[model samples]
Target: MGKAKYLSAVEQGMVVGARRTGLSVSRTATLLCFSCSTFYQELPHKLTEQDRQLLKCVLHKNHLSSVTTLTTEYQTASGSNVSTKTVRRELHEMGFHGRAATHKTKITMHCPNSLLEW
Candidate 1:
């Protein structure tokens, strides 16, 4: 058989189209850079069951959960020590992060009438 052409443009177009119309995987893969076989072979890494449960627990309990807290809790509960770095990696994997700053102006102007009321 002859060498097959890479359909990167078609794949990209399909991905964009999928975003618009939500096409099936086979159709999307047919349009991609690699063949459907390659796409199926290189499926993304998904979280294991144990990790998913642990993440659910961590997220459910804490308001200000951080990597340090999660790692410590995981080690204490499961007797398996995971590094802060590892916890951070896991948090990133699960799409969690510490809160970002609120950009509110701090300065306040007070009127003499307001002061008199106080």
Candidate 2:
């Protein structure tokens, strides 16, 4: 038995070694300078079917629409009850642009004839 040898290599070197190696997973991982368990753990997890659908809908619905309008429509159609902040955060995450306009419309739009009482 002798002292273990450790070689220093950049991240790119490890990737190239992994691609060229024809060995067991553990051996490949050791040559790449990483643990086998860690190598497998680095793989990305797939999104659920529901999440995929939601993402597709979000991407196709509007490109530059107001966040408030999108949130309202999503809530009305899906009944998910997400907050305005969540909607804004999602829009930001998606890399959408444009500022949110201030809402200045009257509270009540339908008003019939009314008599003044002075």
Number of the top lDDT candidate: 1
In candidate 2, how many clashes are counted? 0
Predict model 2's lDDT versus the native.
Answer: 0.59
Which residue pairs show collisions in model 1? Answer: 11-31, 11-32
| Model 2 Cα shift for residue 16 (angstroms) | 44
Off by over 4 Å in 2: 1-59, 99-118
Query: Against the true structure, what is each candidate's TM-score?
Result: 0.46, 0.34
Please report the candidate that would top TM-score against the real structure. Answer: 1
Give each model's whole-structure lDDT: 0.65, 0.59
Question: What's the CA RMSD for each of the models?
Answer: 12.4, 15.9
TM match of model 1 to true structure: 0.46
Total backbone collisions, model 1: 2
lDDT of 2 by residue, 1-118 (tens): 5444443456546654665665666887776666666554443323334643574486467756666777777677666777767666555555755667998977866655573332
